[model samples]
Target chain A: MLDPQIIIAGVLNGLLAGGIYVLVAVGLTLIYGVLHIINFAHGSLLMLAMYAVFFLWRLAGLDPYVSLPLVTAGAFAVGFVLYRLVIGRFSHGKDENILLITLGVSIVADNLALLFFGGDTQTIDVPYAGDIIQVGAAFLPLPKVISCGAALLICLVLGLFMTRTDTGKAIRAVARERQGARLVGIDVEHVFAVSYGIGIACLGAAACLLMPTFYVTPQSGYAFVLVAFTIVVLGGMGSFLGAAVGGFLIGITESLGGLFLGEQLGQIGISLIFILILLLKPTGLFGSRA
Target chain B: MRHLALAAALLAAVVYPLLVPNYLATVGMLMFFTAFIGQSWNISGGFAGQTSFGHAAFFGVGAYTSTILQVTYGWNPWLAWPAAMAMGGLVGAGIAVLSFRAGLRGSYFALITLAFAEVFRIAANSASITRGGLGMLIKADQRPINFQFKDQIWIYYLAFALCLVSLLIAWWLTRSRFGARLVAIRENEDAARALGIDVFTEKVKVLALSGAMCAAGGTFYAQKYLYIDPNIAFGIDKSVEMLLVTMVGGAGTIFGPLIGSIALTTINELTRAAASVFPALKNVQPLSLIVYGAMLVLIVARLPDGFASLLGRRRHA
Candidate 1:
């Protein structure tokens, strides 16, 4: 018998968490779908995006919400360049090689961030930082709601882009068969770059949106990445729809578990869920076994 | 000749700790423990190609089981060690059965292990008996039955013996039929299955064996230090250190984790010492991590078979 008010609060938090999970897992899945690499640096890119929002807000007095577009654009450019120069070389090899290369990229990014920023927590100064909205018996934070909304919008837009656009078709073609896509005269390289760029852009958008609510730090991405990995696995590796649903499920479970079992146990609950899902469904909920 | 090599290696291991200063002795002990754990990891990860990144689950399970039994039930520390090792094996088998049944192999297998470790860490952090993040600290005093010792040499010997046991187990497994099956499965699971190898059974067996060894390492670690914290017990860093060492030295080869562990541990000690001396260089600590990461990339890129293969090729040539 949970309190109705507490339940609503949990739902809100879960929704917000799910939004972030979707954002993180979508990027991971997108990269994996095209390149077949988990892209361990995906989390590092998110950290970079968080820093971008923080600096933009801190240095220029720009609201993180307003700077989201620029961050997305910047992430796209960096991701494009990274794929072209580094990831491209590792793309055509044993999968383990990609894992190692991405791991290297992640290590470099994390250490570089640590070197530059020092290993301390920094946050963007958001207006209405302490403000809350009372919904009937439940209080909801404005920042989380906004972030979730933005996340949903991004997911929708990305879904449309993937389904409707000519470039999106080419990307899907490559994902299905790289050799076949090449045979069809499609620029597989460009598709790889664009897919990676879009993936990073999603992370960039998430970072800017999240900056208002969470603290930005070098190691902050580790927990986020781990959680996102769980969600991605639950959703089925490379399934966009699965990532979205898995995100919400994880968020709800995390928030509800936090409320019932306490914060520390809540974290363990998520990890247990991952193990349980992995042990139960090898193909994942949405993953199609070809 | 084999016996002679063993005697020589044992002599070097025993005497080196005594020759080194106390600080260096401690570092050597740490390296020995790391090597043991890395060898344990190598059994399942390297030999079986499971890539389990969550040996910390077994490590923590061992530490907690023994620590709690010794402190609460007033069990003898020596008795608790076997209990811990057994518990580790059981848990390892459980994890193997669960994960393998679900088709979790390779990277997915690694992910599951990491998830389990995280779960264990969180559980330890929350459980009241384990002191719930305040951690467990044994009274630091010299008592033989208590398994507490003031002299670094005693702890050094104990860790050294544990390392020997671990290495022996790894070697024994390598020469066993189980080891052959594991190698076959690692090379190609489908082909192995076709060739009448019980792939799942071999994987689970290797995972359990590795888990037991790692757990024993954890138990000894807790006894020596007389302190057990959830963060250290179920740390991702500990798991990574094991993997990095094995990968660097050579996977799927006898004595690879031994070499990797010693080399990496020494490097870690140097990095930590350097970082402390040059407080201005806080980021210097990450230099080792960066190098380790780069090494992983290079090994995967150029030397997929690891350092052992390079040595073997040189010998053959």
Candidate 2:
């Protein structure tokens, strides 16, 4: 049997990674809930946010943590404009068209990053970049611990907002039934824009949290986006709480999978689970039948 | 008038190869190969209304299987073609069974397919037989029996034949009951099921056929390219290229894949040529992808029916 400390460390690492997945997956589920379009470009939007944070850190000498709100706000504005200008035109179009459009957006965003950043992998260097915290027998990296906490806190705040705020209720109303929402005098289009913006805003926040610990590359979002997809599907689509739980589950799976299956096969393990879950329960663990 | 048009087109196809330079012939070969792949994709995607984003899985299986067989066992590459198709079909059937049994539709199905491809790619990367990222290189031999051609013309002819075969199959499908059933499923699955259509079985069968055809294209690709790498064989970009070619031509139509492939290949060649001629553009990143993305956006926004629809309108006029 493995050492208790090793297992605990792995679990901690998985939880940290799961926190990031939760944030990204929640955003994806939110967009899916309201817009009913699987935004293939969600990862690309996160890529852009990473770049934004990188530039802020490099040029303005701001720490990634300090720049979180700024990046989130910036991403929100961009997402809102993008929806109004491009996505709004195809709100009622075929699912395939919406899928293609978002894919197009992804390709454009990825190539644009390549053109501008020249494909070099960059990372932000903060004072606590090498710091660690001790938890009994297990040691936790400070960055991971902090980011994971922040992610959970954000999810909690989002949960409260969803249940408490009128706009949040309106968004939910639209998601449940668009026609009924419109009949009740909800501005469905505005809600869509807001939902998309919030979804992207989550990506921006995730970028800031992730930058300190992870390398930022033009293609970095591709793998993370895939992981987020698995998480969203496993947790149940359109369920925020499910995404959070699913995030932790995938995180733990990846960490333990890496520990046992070797580094490369760890990814395969996640994919296998994703496929099995999809085949066994298309509705996901917490999702209702569509 | 239709017969005359067909005769003229056939004559041009037969004679143009003899007249064009080898480089242009190579481009023509690529266009046709892409069209073949696109048409195969259309069987499941357009006709059956099942969008797959992981076709590269089937494609990569074909390329890797044939290449590995030839390299390891000195097997005739021609023999490897059927093996590739069988492998592709098996994988396709597996995916179809699992996904359909679970009732995965639309994006869920697409994502699952992507996951499978990614798994395959990662497996290829780690497996020693696949050479683990160094890639497999086939020796250049101009023997006809080895499926290697001394001249590019033979390759062009082979690709043209394959394209014609795929087109004929697609055309036959349009006139068959299976094709009609596929169309019914595409338009409305629940309604078709209510009408006594075995939705699950039909989808799996169509997917298997599509996978087999795509696998054949992969074998042809490996034989021509003389190299097999995980990235080249299993890349998501390859899958996207297939989808783009089919969609731009007009999904669900016999000639759509052909037109889309020709248009996309032309655009790609033109961009490369322009990039080479301009010194300033040399150091700059290649603009082909940006153009592709822009084209996708423009097409989705303004020309969802694709360029094939424009041709259809002119024919009616």
Alpha-carbon interface RMSD for all candidates, in angstroms: 1.9, 1.6
After superposing candidate 1 on the true structure, give the runs of residues whose Cα lies further than 4 Å from its correct spot: A91-97, B1-10, B272-279
Candidate 2: which stretches are off by over 4 Å?
B283-286
Candidate 2 chain B worst ten-residue window by lDDT = B279-288
Give one digit per residue, the lDDT tens place, for model 2 in A196-269: 99999899999999999998888887787788888888888888878989999999999998988788767787
Among these predictions, the greatest TM-score belongs to: 2
Could you tell me which residue pairs clash in candidate 2?
none
Which candidate ranks first by lDDT, i.e. highest? 2
Q: Give me the chain B TM-score of candidate 2.
A: 0.96
Q: Show the lowest summed lDDT stretch of 10 residues, model 1 chain A.
A: A89-98
Clash total of candidate 2: 0
List each candidate's DockQ score.
0.61, 0.63
Cand. 1: chain B TM-score: 0.93
lDDT, candidates in the order shown: 0.83, 0.88
lDDT of 1 at B310: 77
**lDDT tens readout by residue for model 1, A133-206:** 88777777888888898899999999898889999899999999999999999998899999999999989999
Candidate 2 lDDT score relative to the true structure: 0.88
